[model samples]
Target: MTVTTDIAQRQERRERLVLDHFADETRQDFDAVLATFAHPRYELIPGGEVLDGRDPVHAYYLQTRRAFPDQRHEIIKLRHTEDAVIVEFWLLGTHRGPLNGLPPTGNAFRCRMIALFIFEGETLVCERVYFDSLTMIRQLLAGVSPEALPQVLSGLLEKVPAQTPAVA
Candidate 1:
């Protein structure tokens, strides 16, 4: 086989793997999702969190899914590069469980996200995801009742740092 042909074949395989990974996540089939990863890693950019092994990654998945049981993605675009497949997508979910010390809001959020599916040869190594946390947070608290606003606001403030960075 020619070099160009081999490159094309590799690209096809990566795309297939990425699609299967998304499908498995949407299905909440954790085992299947883990199988797709070479070492099972995730980098949540917004939260500055790195889950870099099977156990930690698995636990992270469980925690997030518990909070948003119906979480799923809608792919907007997929672009392949030499070492990564960058995906633009919408992450949709309903807040049904406690998240970050806050009680369930029962609100649905659809946040646009971008993820870089980094690969090692033909195997996926890490999924580095980027999104605005505030967008999801606002959506989750949008339906809060007037009576609950104070309590909800208080909970949110607890999660925020007391000191704010000065403008450069």
Candidate 2:
């Protein structure tokens, strides 16, 4: 096979593996989800958190799955370069469990995310992700009574940082 074909195959496989991992997480298949990672060196960015090994990654998935039990991730775009694959997607779910310390609101939420995967051979070694935090927070607080919407809005407006960086 040509070098280009080989790279394409590897990139496709890596994307499949990562998407499968997300599907498994939605189904609460923690073991299947955790097995997709490489090893202790695997790193996931965007959240600014590093998972030392499979165990920590597994824990992270557990918490996330529990919080968004109905979550489904849709891959809207995928592009493969020399040594990495970039995926743009949307995470759709309902807030049925605690998320970022917020109680369940049962409100549906949709958040766009982009992940860049760095590959070593056929395995993914690192992933950098970007998503909208404000949307997540809004959905999490949607369960408040109608009378409390103004209060929530006021709080969020007041909490907005002075120097909010614009997302690219």
Candidate 3:
């Protein structure tokens, strides 16, 4: 195959892998989602959390699913770069279980996110995500005005300094 065609094929595979990972996550298929990673790892930029390896990643998934049983994403865009597939998406879910010492409010949240599906060649090594943490806190808290979000988030953030930021 020509160099151009080979590169295109690689990009296609990476794109497919990213989509498959998202699908698996939405389905809550742990094994399939884990299979997408050649070297599984996640980075939560604003949340300042890092989880590597299958065990930790699985636990993170469980913790999140407990809090938001219907957590899923709606992709807005996907950009394939030389080293990563960047995705812009909206995460939607309802608070069903305890999260960060906060009881379930039965409130729902839809937060926009941008994530980098970092890779080594075609092997996905990490999925690093960035999003507004305050939006989620305010949303889950129910009817909390944006005016008071800073004070509310400041106190809550300290309590949950290491929430696994999800948007893969």
lDDT of 2 by residue, 42-108 (tens): 3433334556677777777777777787788888988888777888999888877865445567888
lDDT of each: 0.88, 0.71, 0.87
Q: Tell me the alpha-carbon RMSD of every candidate.
A: 4.0, 4.8, 4.2
Say which candidate scores most in lDDT. 1
Clash totals, every prediction: 0, 0, 0
Q: Could you tell me how far off, in angstroms, the CA of residue 145 lies in candidate 3 after the best superposition?
A: 12
Candidate 1 Cα outliers beyond 4 Å, as residue runs: 146-150, 153-168
Write down the TM-score for model 1: 0.88
For residues 1-168, could you state the per-residue lDDT of candidate 3 as single tens digits? 899998899989999999999999999998999999986798888767888899989988998999999999999999989999999999999999877666677899999999999989979999999999889877898866668667655655566664554544
lDDT of 1 by residue, 59-148 (tens): 978988999999999999999999999999999999999776678999999999999999989989899999999999889999788899
Best-fitting candidate, scored by TM-score? 1
Model 3 alpha-carbon miss at residue 160, Å: 3.0
Task: Give the Å shift of residue 122 in candidate 3.
Answer: 1.3
